[model samples]
Each structure stands twice: as C-alpha cells, then as structure tokens.
Target: MKWQNALKDYQLYLKIERGLSENSIENYSRDVKKLMVYLESHNIDEAPTTITTEIIQGFIYSISKSVNARSQSRIISGLRSFFSYLVFEDYMTSNPLELIESPKIGRKLPDTLSENEINDIINAIDLSKPEGERNRAILETLYGCGLRVSELINLKISDLFFNEGFIRVTGKGDKQRFVPIIDVTQKYINIYRNEIRNHLNIQAGFEDTLFLNRRGKQLTRAMIFTIIKQLAEKIGLKKNISPHTFRHSFATHLLENKADLRSIQLMLGHESITTTEIYVHLDKSHLTNVVEEFHPRRQSLKK
Candidate 1:
C-alpha cells in the first residue's frame, strides 16, 4: 500500500480504536511521514509493507545525528507502534521493529518549582493591565488543579462546580475527571470571570470557554507557555520552565506532604501508578519518611 494510505488508516485507528487525542495522533502521524520523506528523497521506491529493516535503520541513523537520545527514542517508539498496528490489521505479516531496541537513556525527572518560587512568579504579575486578573487566575488554576496546558485552555464555564469544590477536567484521550478546587483558586477565577472575561466581547462559539485571548477567542497552548516564560523571566527564575512546570510542582509538593500516590495519580489523571512514582524520586525524603512512620521495625530502630 502507498505510504499516504497507510498513514491515513493508522490515524483512523488511533482515533476510533485507541481514542488518542488529536495532538497525539499528529505526533504519531508525523513519525511515519518522516520515513516517507526519507524514502522519497533517496529515490527508494519502497511501499509501507515493502520497506526493509535496512532502509528503516538508515532513516533512524540519519535522525540520530540531529536529535537527542530521548527524542530519537520517542521517534523509534512511534514507528514501532505504527508497524505493530499494521501487523494487527493484516497489512503486514510481522513487525519490522519487533527486534529493534531503543537506546539506553536515563529517566529524566521533571523540573519543579518550590512554593516560594511559585509565589514569586505569581506575585510578578502586572495587575494594572486588563488581563492581569485573568493571568493570575490562569496560573492559579494551572498550579492549583495540576492541569495540563491543553486541559486548562479547553476548560469550560459549565465545568466549574464551586459548591461541590470540584472542577471537571478533560484530560488526555478525552477522558474526564473531577479534580478538587481550593477556595483561593475559586476566588481568583470568580474575579476573572466577573471582572475581566465578562467584560470582553466574546466571539461566537467561545462563550463557554473559560480562558480567552484579547480577541475573545480561546487561548492557544503556545500563549500559555509564553505567559509562564515571561513570568519566570520577570522573577529572575534562571531555570527553564513552561506550563507543565506547575503540574510537576503540584505533584511533587503533594508527595512531600505525605499524600498517597494513588490520589495524586487520579488527580493528575495519569493512567498508571508508575507515571506518578516519578514524584517519589523527586523527593527521596518522602520514601524515608514513609518507612520511618509506618514500618513495623521503626520503634525498635529508634533505640
């Protein structure tokens, strides 16, 4: 089959069967498209099913020179999944990447901000501007609720449940969950909604969108990153940070305070407990405290 047709089918499968988000689907499709470009540029007339391991290896080798090991590993994984899907659908007899292995790479821990740093970043906001209250609310929601950038942008007015103290979040794969919201976060959101958002000339179809651009359209993910970057710069934060930094801080702080992994996992909407375990590594003291507080031999060890 042609590479284009195969890619189209793979995207459909990702959406309909796997229920992947549009961003994820785009990333997966891009991996396959890269291989197609490689083949076409080299004048190698190989179809999706006919492409050999040697050709695939050449494509990978070419990319490894430019990308870091982590990014290269992700591309390899994406290609493996694509071929595996083909095999599942009888498009191929076996997966070419079945024998290939990803490069050895250490687990990269996420960067987190301390409470002081977070407070400093929030305090740097210019409240004199019209978007000032809105910006403060955005940061608060991002850190307070442990939301992904996509989730924060897509949040709707109807999703707020202040009386119940929960804000419904639509996480990756379109899965929905209700996360608890603190009174402080609610107050900031109310200020934005009443003072800033309500006064904007909201365009059609964006009336329900909780966060908006100056044009009354929904905020983009890039805009969220820019806002955080500017705040970090204003506060002289030397560390590189993005919208996801707040999420990492939220998870890490919860672990340090002795919150259970499963609860944090659910709040972050992670599908696996293993993903949440990264926070345990962020603070080894938490593990030590767990053993000190709960272990049966702790009383004897005190002696």
Candidate 2:
C-alpha cells in the first residue's frame, strides 16, 4: 500500500478508534510525514509495507544531527506506534521498529514559579488598559485551575459552575473533569466577563467562549503565551516560562501545601498517578514532612 494511504488510515484510526484529539493526531502524523519526506529526498521508492528497518534507522541517523535526544525519542516512538498499527492490521508481518530502542534521555523537571513570582507577574499587568482585566483573569484561571493551554483557550462561560465552585475542563483525548475553582479566581473571571467580555461584539460562534480576542473570537494558544511572556518580561523575571509553568507551579504548590497526589492528578487531568509524581521531585521538604508526620516510628523516636 502507498505510504500516504496507510498514513490516512492511521490518522482515522487514531481519531475514531483511539479517540485522540486533533492536536495529538497531527503530532503522530508528523513523524510519519518526516519519514516520507526523507524517503522522497533520498530517491528511495518504497511503500510502508515494503520499508525495511535499515531505512528507518537511516532516517533516525539523519535526524540525529538536527534534533535533541528527547525529540529523537519522540519521533522514534511515534513511528513505532504507526508501524505497530500496521502490524496489528495485518498489513505487515512484523514491525520494523520493534528492535529499535529509544535514546536514554534524562527526565527534565518542569519549571515552577514561586508565589511571589506569580504575584509579581500578575501585578505587572497595567490595569488601566482595556485588556488588563481580561489578562489578569486569564492568568488567574490558568494558575488556579491548573489548566493546560488548550483547555484554557477552549474554556467556555457555560463551563463555570460558580455556585458549586467547580469548572468543567475538557482535557486530552476529550476527557472531561471538574476542577475546583477558588473564590479569587471566580472574582477575576466575573470582572473580565462583566467589564470587558460583555462589551465585545462577540462573533456568532464564540458567544460561549470565555476568553476572546479583540476580534471577539476565542483566544489562540500563541496569544496566551505572548501575554505570559510579556508579563514575565515586564517583571524582569529571568527564568524561561510558558503557559505550562503555571500548571506545574499549581501542582507543585498544592503538593508543597500537603495536598495529596491523587487530588492534584485529578485536578490536573493527568491520566496516570506516575505523571503527577513528577511534582514530588520539586519539593523534598514535603516528603520529609510527610514522613515526620505520618511515620509510625516518628513518635517512638521523639520519646
């Protein structure tokens, strides 16, 4: 079969059978596309079913000069998944990537902002501007709700159940979860809604969207990053941060304050507890406190 045809089928399967989001499907497709491009540029004419492990290895070797280990590992993983899908469908007898091993990359810890830094970034916003209130609300929602950039951008006014103190978030794979909202976050949102968003001549389709651009449409992910970047610069903060930093800070702070990992995982919409455990690495003191407080031998040792 043609590589393009196989890729098209794979994307459909990812969407329909696996129930992955569009963004995820695109990322997965990108890896296969890279291999296809490599084949074309090298004048190698081979279908997906006929491709050998050596060709794939050559592609990996060619990319190693340009990409870091982490990215190379991801590409390898993506391609492996695609080939595994082919094997599962009986298009191939064996996977070409089955013997390939991903590079050993260190676990990169996420950067987190302290409470002071978070406040400083928010405070740097000029409240005099028309979008200031909206920006503030956006930051508040991002940090308070521990939302992913996609989740924040897609948030709707109807998703807010203020009376119940919960905001519904649709996370990866279209999975929905209810995250608790603090009163402070709710207050800022209300300010933005009543003061700024209400005045926008919202486009027809974006009527329910919580955050809007000047064109009265939903905000883009890049727009949110730009807002945070400007704020960080205004405050003279040096650490490189993005929209995800707030999420990491949110989970880290909660863990520092003695919140359980399971609860943080639920709020952060992590698929596995292992994903949430990364935050524990940020605060060794919290673990010490846990041991001191809960360990049965602690009381005996104190006596």
List the candidates' TM-scores in order: 0.98, 0.98
Model 2, position 124, has a per-residue lDDT of: 94
1-303 per-residue lDDT for model 2 (tens digits): 998899999999999999899999999999999999999999999999988999999999999999999999999999999999999999999999999999999999999999999999999999999899999999999999999999999999999999999999999988999999999999999999999999999999999999999889999999999999999999899999999999999999999999999999999999999999999989989999999998989978988
Q: Tens digit of lDDT per residue, candidate 1, span 1-303?
A: 988889999999999998999999999998998888888888999888877788888998989988988988999999999999989989889888887778889999999999999999999999999999999999999999999999999999999999999999999888999999999999999999999999999999999999999899999999999999999999899999999999999999999999999999999999999999999999999989998898989978887
What candidate 1 gets wrong by more than 4 Å, as runs, is: 300-303
Candidate 2's C-alpha lDDT? 0.96
In candidate 1, how many Å is residue 158 off? 0.5
Model 1 RMSD vs true structure: 1.2
Q: Which candidate leads in lDDT?
A: 2
> Scored by Cα lDDT, where does model 1 land?
0.94
